[model samples]
Target: MKIAILGTGAGGRCHAAKLLELGHEVIVGTRDPDATLARTAPDHMGTPPYRDWLAAHPGATVCTFADAAAAADLVINGISGDHALNALTAIKDQLAGKTLIDYAVPYVYQHDSAHKWPTPWGFMPLLDPVDSDSLAEQIQRALPETRVVKSFVTQEQETVVDPKSIGGGDHTMFVSGDDEAAKGRAAQLLREYGWTDIVDLGPLVTARGLEMYAHFHSAVGLALGRRFGVKIV
Candidate 1:
């Protein structure tokens, strides 16, 4: 499969690394592709670094956000939560008819009176706080023609990359989307990343629940002084 992953942070890098391992042609899109390459060498022997990873992937080469969306069989939005909407808005035109795998959490932090901390100690999950229409719903509305599947937001970056640390035996992933085919495709990619146990929560509306789950995960991690993760029983 020809895959394009936007953003080069830990989440993006992890997805790119796993995709490369699975023998899928992967394109990594970043704002400063050249600087990114200069900083980190390609971990995979055959993989190539690119301001435009599409070119190295062969049959597909990286261009602008619009180009990547238009050319790719699958487009993974691995950008940070704050930048997800803006990044996708930049290439909205090319997203029609494409399958978009959205992994984002809108979490705003506020000081917790109970903690008596100067800075915000608790996160305000935007899942319910952000009006009736959630972030995923907004994206779906913006690109009606595109099939959007939401997944991988409940867990931290580390857990997704190395499940073993969090009782890797049968880690679970929750996926929700309006399109069954799109959700199925996303599940296939999850399996490629070595996620064997997946829960299809059904429809894009279920994303709200998953986002709240992420907030809980974050809160628990903060309280425990550790990087918390989840697994399915």
Candidate 2:
């Protein structure tokens, strides 16, 4: 499949590299591919610069967000949760009839005095109302033509790439999408990537739980001093 992964950050790089390994024709989408190529700094997760990562994966290519979407059979949205909507909206015209796998958690930025706990990612509130309408649901509504599947969002960095790294891949992943076929496709990719346990939460609205899960993930990370995925025993 010709896949386009949006974003050049840790999430994007990890997902793109794995897809390339699986023999998919992967093209990464960025707001400015040219500028990304010029970046010398490492990603937030301290991974090597994206240019270096790209160099390692010669099979992958980069292009503007719109162009990448236009050419892909499937699009895996690896853009940051905060900016995903804007990025997809810019490329909306090209997404019709495409199975878009969205792996972004919508984390709203609080600009008011209610500044919350400080984390590695920044100062986001400890609790927010992602349930009113999850980010994935909003995206589906905004792009009525696209089949958006929400999966592989509960993890990040290396763990996002290989869930098996933790608990021997025994942990579970939740997938939610209005389109059943789209969820199946995303689940296939997850299994290809060595995910042994996958949970179908049903309907795109179930994304509310997935998006809210970021809080639980972060809390456990902070409490235990490490990242842990949710598992059904």
Candidate 3:
């Protein structure tokens, strides 16, 4: 598969490495490819720069967002929640009829000047009207012609690359999308990454729950005092 991951940050690099390991041709997409490569410091999440990860994964290459999306068989929206909407919206034309795997939560990153305390996962606030709309639904609405499947938003970035590290043997993944075939394709990729218990929670609107579930996932992280995930059981 010619897979394009939209973002060279931790989640993107992790997924790109896994895809390459699975023998897929991976192109990592970013708004500014050069800037992403030139990044010398670790990201806010503490993952090493993309350049560092790219050094280990030689098979994967970097490209502008448009080029990556235009050349891909499938596109993974691994971009951060804050920037995902604008980035994907701009390239909706190329995404038509293609399956897009959305891994972003609906939270927008913001500095907490008033309080030093942070949410369980980290400090961030959700975009407006979250009760009525989800990030995945918004993307689906914005790109009505494209098939969008939402998954992987509730896990830590490490779990995306390696689901086995989570102590829970049956950690579950909830996928939501309007297109069955598209959801199937997304599930296949998740299976390749070793996710066994995946639940298709109906159509795209169900993403409201999947995205909102991040808060609980974070609470689990807090209890564990480490990165964590969820399980249906």
Candidate 4:
């Protein structure tokens, strides 16, 4: 399968490497291929440069966002929350009639708050479409022809791609979308990633809870000083 991961961040890298190991052709999308490869410093989260990661994984390819989307049979929206909308909307034509598994949270990284929920990284970022709306719904609306399924938002990035590392893979993952087939495809990918328990929370609106769970996930991670999994039992 040709899969396009529309970001070069740590989360995107995790998916890219896993997909490659699964024998899928991985095409990673970035704002600028040259700029991404030229970076020597780590990202804000201290993730190593793209070039360094690319060196470790030789099978994966890097290209512009549109090129990657155009070449892939399936697309994964790993773009950051703040830039996902604009970046995706720009290549709407390429993504039409494709299954896009979006795991982005609509987080506004910069905000003014009198009181904030502090974490190991800093105050937790604010969710833009909190309560009433979700990033998945927004992307679905933006690309009406694309089948969008929301998943992978509820777990830590590394644990998401490698569920067995935590709790012996005895946890649950959730998928939400109006399109049944798309949700099925997303669940199949989760299974390939070693996830045994996947719940299909019907309709894209349920993404509100999946995304909003980020705050609680962060709080728990900080409290535990490590990554953990959630089992729906």
Candidate 5:
């Protein structure tokens, strides 16, 4: 299957690399492919430039967000939380009648906060539309024709792609979406990525819980000082 990963961030790269290894044709989407490839330095997250990463994995194709989505059978939205809605909306025509697995948490960085939850790197980014609404739900509303499934937001991208790295791949992965078939597609991909335990949280609104868990996920990672996984059992 041809899969489009709509982002060039570390998370997107993780999915792209893993998908290529899984024998799927991968198309990576970005706002500007040229600018994404011209980067010589790492991103704020310190993930190396896209060009450097692409060099190691030449099988994946990089193009504009719309072009990638147009060519894909399925789409994984790795776009940053703040920009995903607008970015996906811009390519609405290409994504109609397709399953969109959104893993982005709507994080508004550098916001004013009376009580800051500082991390080893910086303060925890704020999640807008957090408790009552979620980025996944927002995207679903924005693109009425697209089937949106929320997954992969509960864990770091590394663990998401290679679940065996923690707990012998026994951890639980959750999927939430309005479309059953779309959620099934996401579960299939997770299984391909080596996830053995998956729970369907039922309906897109459950995405609020997944997105809101970001803070807790970060807190646990900081406390342990490592990458970890969570299991329902």
Candidate 6:
């Protein structure tokens, strides 16, 4: 599969690396692909330079957001939730009829005046309040033609990539989308990444609940000293 991953941040790099390791062709779309690749190359295991990476991997190519989405069989949105809508809207036309896997958390940035104690030792999801609608639902509403599957939003990057650190147990992942086939494809990808526990929580509307899970998870992480992931045991 030719996958285009947007954003050059940790989330994007992590997803791109995993996809590349899985033997799928990957194209990383970013504002500065060359620079981003150079910075991230060393840390990525078995990942070649962006130019060399593209050459070594058949059908893999990186370009700006528009071209990337236009050329990919699958486009994964790894951008922050705050910028996701705008970024997709810019390339909305190119994304028609595409299977888009959205991993976004609408996190409203505000100073924690209360300075909640007992914060987790590791990273936690910072959720945005006041947005009554979930990011996935909003994107689907905006682009009805595109098949959107919501997954990979509940856990941190490390947990998604290497589940063992979180206890090496069966970790659960939620998939919610209006399209069954798209959800199935996403679930397969999750399984390949070593996620043994997966739940198809029904239609896209369920994304709202999944997004809320991030908030609760964050609070718990803050309460505890560790980022112990949630698992349905």
Tens-place lDDT per residue, model 5, 49-120, is 989999999999999999999999999999989999999999999999999999999999979999988877
Model 2 lDDT at residue 188: 88
Q: What 10-residue stretch in candidate 4 is worst by lDDT?
A: 114-123
* lDDT scores of the candidates, listed in order: 0.71, 0.84, 0.84, 0.93, 0.94, 0.77
Which candidate number has the best lDDT?
A: 5
Report the alpha-carbon TM-score of model 1 versus the true structure. 0.77
Q: lDDT by residue for model 6 over 1-233, one digit each (tens)?
A: 88899875667767777788888888778766667556635433343445544455444456788888888899889877888888888888989999999988886544454544344343333555324768898899888889999988888765776666677846678899999999988888888888888899999988988888876787777668576777776
- Residue pairs in candidate 4 whose N, alpha carbon or C atoms collide under 3 angstroms: none
Number of backbone clashes in candidate 1: 4
Report the C-alpha displacement of residue 62, candidate 5, in angstroms: 0.6
Candidate 1 residue lDDT tens string, 1-233:
88888776667766776677678787666655557656435533233454344334344344456666776799988766666777787788888888999887765443333533231543353443354556787788878888999988877655675566666536688899999999999888877666778899988988878766765676677788776556666
Candidates in order, TM-scores: namely: 0.77, 0.92, 0.91, 0.98, 0.98, 0.80
Worst 10 residues of 5 by lDDT: 116-125
Judge candidate 6 at residue 180 and give its lDDT: 93
> lDDT of model 1 at residue 52?
42
Candidate 3, 56: how far from true, in Å?
1.5
> Measured by C-alpha RMSD in angstroms, how accurate is candidate 1?
5.7
Q: Please say which candidate is ahead in TM-score: 1 or 3.
A: 3
- C-alpha RMSD by candidate, in order: 5.7, 2.0, 2.3, 0.8, 0.8, 4.7
lDDT of candidate 5 at residue 65, scale 0 to 100: 95
lDDT by residue for model 3 (1-233), tens: 89999888777877888889899999888888789889999887787888888888889988899899989999999887877888899998888878999988766566555654465555647444377888898899889988999988878767866888886446887789999999999889888999898999999999888788876776677777887666786
Q: Predict model 4's lDDT versus the native.
A: 0.93
lDDT: worst 10-residue window of model 2: 122-131
